[model samples]
Target: MKILSKNLIKLRDIKTFKFKKAMINYQHVEIVNHFMKKPLILVINCGSSSLKFSLMDPKTGEESLNGIAQCLLSDNANISFKVNGEKQVLALLPPFDHNTAIVELVNFITKNNLFEQITAIGHRVVHGGEKYHQPTLITPQVKNEIAKLAKLAPLHNPANLVGIEATEKVFSHLLQVAIFDTAFHQTMPEKAYIYGLPYNLYQEHGIRRYGFHGTSHYFVTQRASSLLQKPLEQCNFISAHLGNGCSISAIVNGKSVDTSLGFTPLEGVVMGTRSGDIDPSIIFYLVEQLGYSLDQVNTLLNKESGLLGISGISNDCRTIEEQLLAGNKRAKLAIDVFCYRIAKKIASFSASLDNLDGLIFTGGIGENSNTIRSLILNQLSLLGFKANEQLNEEIRFGKQGNINDTTSRPCWVIPTNEEWVIAEQTQHLLINKGM
Candidate 1:
């Protein structure tokens, strides 16, 4: 506890915090209680308009408390949380920002004395650019770097920094760690991540493929490697993270060799809102020939395209599936495009591997929607992935297990625990730094 006090004192002086010190892990070493053995790690992820948090046991992957502040900064802003097993919802009055939300959450934690045993806070930052490649202790300069990366990921990185800054003020004494979603993909080789554009654009603008959904892909890869009874460093597979925002990773020997998303997350397969892979010419055409501005073209590609764009309805797969059953042709077309694009990407990623060991499905649609899985697997029949009809039908609504038949390569529907990944990385860094 004395050492903890001394180390945290350095953080008190903002002017003295260096960039190099920000790269090092800051841990508070104190004799812990023998009665309650496990230390708690708080993981936080902020979307453009929502904040999700979890209090977890990093050693056991156990979550004691988890929740989300949804519809943030709006009239309908509310927090839905679970304590142990019981669930509760608290509505916040209008105009609640991240700072106000943090104040409320901190008060709740204090009322229950939850912060007394917390060892560290792990924040899920989306874009690290070329500056950060691993988890780092949060500092003022590190926060500024995160803010600067907002130019690359406007919808995500800035909002992530907000959560980090708010949590810093609330839990000022505890160590705060920033875990980048792009960190796991740092192992990707240049040949796989490079674009075919002008060399100067790549050198000067930092415009190269930086994949997203990395933590989820990494977690599911580890789980799949374990289930296959092979060492993680010896496993090869394709990981498809199917959610509102989706990406597929080609992991060879447990390292991400290639991924679907590029430069930004807008260059991959079709997502809920984003038009994943439209030609660059279309943007120029829209601006010059269709009388639209650059900003409007950007909005059309990122917000008005993909599933919603095709179906002329909701971006949700479930809703589209319902409409497909109701004989909606556009809805069927939307789903067909979604599944086909994923299948094509998975097939293409297999070319990057020497030999395929397995294929993993994760995230919301991958874990829950059996129909989507079947649609995708049916297109990959040439690759010997025969998803068992009964197994796919059985695993629904968060149930995870193998969904392949005897003659097929292993296909797993593992529910991803990205928060657990963040906590594990935080703990591993602490151990490596001899905290």
Candidate 2:
């Protein structure tokens, strides 16, 4: 009994010593983080089949890490990234999902000694409905609200929620903020958002046009304002975010007064697969005359239409452009329809503005495709837009500059920075909330 008691006392003493040492180590880590490390925000944007992440210094707008996990939940799932300008790729094993992807990302950050500097996590939520008008800190109620709004943005919100939940588990000690894509468009007026449906239906069902890609739009708007040397509130321009998914917004005094995307992303200009602005009667005709179930019709419109449907080739603009160069008639038709629709939408949005300052273009197609830009600009000659062929051709592949002639209004190719906007907003929210 005496020997056993002595051993127990020794065990207790050792535990106490270890505890004290751990506390000292923790204090040292805190001191180093405070003095040596700049607070970095980890921005996450999760799609249905992909997850994009970036570790950024919000103050300096410098990205330490940028990557995407593509083809999730499949055998070929892999992640490609650049850490401090060095590129690398890693394949994931089977049974990987968002949670697994996040864990791997956290492990990668820790391995590279960058985890200690990440002070918070920011999620790019696609829908905030009317509940969130700005960047909001995530809570249980907020999660529920985002989930509910998935009905409005099925392809986006649920994935965003999954990312948020997974990130919460992996970074339980860090603050998580949701920078919504719809939040910046909340400034839109009632007349601009209201539909022509019955008043009660809109009021009761919460069915109104809620714009998407607001983060991208807001980012380019700020850049345009800066380039034009005008205050944000004084800048009036039409910003087009053209990619696989397209939306155009009319910015009056830096606020979105009207936008092409309506209650859903499918209501705007033609997208990769979505049939934007189809006659409602066509849906009824497909159902009653063509023998299509509602689900099948939904799939057809959202997944099998647009450039792919018109070209009968591929949804990718680059591929379509190549085919057009090869004198493919269907490809020409697809390009013509795409450019005409966008140009028509831009002209319509001009009615919402008193004086057009300039035109801004950003996104995948907008930034890279000078051919499409020139084609669209040619259609807008009446609006005083004359594309400088040399300048337009030069300002692509991560280049940003005016692509307009000296006598015409400015047309810019500002690369959109949605991730930076998310990071900066997350930092600002933390500072405001004293977190």
Candidate 3:
């Protein structure tokens, strides 16, 4: 295998312009230009019908801007854009999807002069398949590559492309880049990603274990090495991102040698409403025995499953925990099943990584909910991981910190920063585009 250099590209002093001409901002300086050491970046993470954006300073590693467009297609579609901690809401017309939300977002930014110094725009694309393995400047070819992956992530990639297109229209002269959610795990070897199925199917259809949450995995790996004060090439860790969606990743020498999410986010550990790691036979069982259709079974696994289906209650981990405290048997069952699955997956990832340095918990459930963190680590005693209850409880809802003892493998609560990564990449690609 060819060895790729472990290079860290700094975005503070970068300026790139490709086919798109660079925006000429040589005259009037903005407030950001006064004491700025880092380039300003605009990042867009578009969901099925929602758009989440953030502004960041790559030099200072600070997230300095944020925006959210929720219920994008609803009658009450509105957007919340923030900067310097102050946020404003702008209501859009009826049936505003991601395509329209992005346009209005650009309008708001223009009216407020928010984009006065925005160097570039970065899009969080859900899947890049095996072709795009790094942050790519959005050109005709790059946009086509992202569009091809839409079949793999219909709910996400389409919306991502929409934002990319709309941004190109508005920020016509600025660099637009794509940072895929699957790029970080492009380091995985074929043996681990290949299923037991025939080789022809994979070769013909481009089907394999294409992991999700690459950005979250990337952030946690860096944080792990930082906490250990070890070079990333010498650090090894497992990252578990547990929210409405959950996936575990194994990091070896700063790369994702393996990951829990396979082919799609639906294949990982159980999530709020998504079934993770279910036997394929279950689908047949539901279809033949339960007389259910394939679409129904698909909905079963992707929606009406996991904690929601198991507990017969809400899928929110907090709600399920509250129900458990109220003596709900089904809720307790759901919580137990979720934690057990996470522990089991983490143990497997440890074997894949071998010589595990530590384990990290991010995402909503992983960062907060000390009970779940405690439960997960309790099952990990055999792996030399022990969390301090007091530390875990104290940081249940605070800034990122550690939860494990000093002598432990170095487990901690590192907050996931996909938006930050996106923003940084945006600034980098913008600066590099010209060169």
Error of 3 at 28 (Å): 13
Which is superior by TM-score, 1 or 3? 1
For 333-421, candidate 1 gives per-residue lDDT tens digits of 99999999999999998779899998999999999999999999999999999989999999888787899988999999999999999
What's model 1's lDDT at 43?
A: 93
> What is the TM-score of each predicted model, taking all chains together?
0.92, 0.92, 0.90
After superposition, the stretches of candidate 2 with alpha carbons farther than 4 Å from their true spots are 1-33
Reference-based lDDT, residue 297, model 2 = 97
lDDT per residue for candidate 3 within 265-332, as digits (tens), equals 89988899998987799888999999999999888899999989999999999999999999999999
Give lDDT for model 1.
Answer: 0.86
Model 1, C-alpha of 308: deviation from truth (Å): 0.6
lDDT: the better of candidates 1 and 3:
1
Q: Cα lDDT of all candidates, in order?
A: 0.86, 0.88, 0.80
Stretches off by above 4 angstroms in model 1 are 1-29, 32-36
Judge candidate 3 against the unseen true structure and give its global Cα lDDT, from 0 to 1.
0.80
Candidate 2 vs candidate 3: the lDDT winner is 2
Record all residue pairs in model 2 with backbone atoms less than 3 Å apart, i.e. clashing.
none
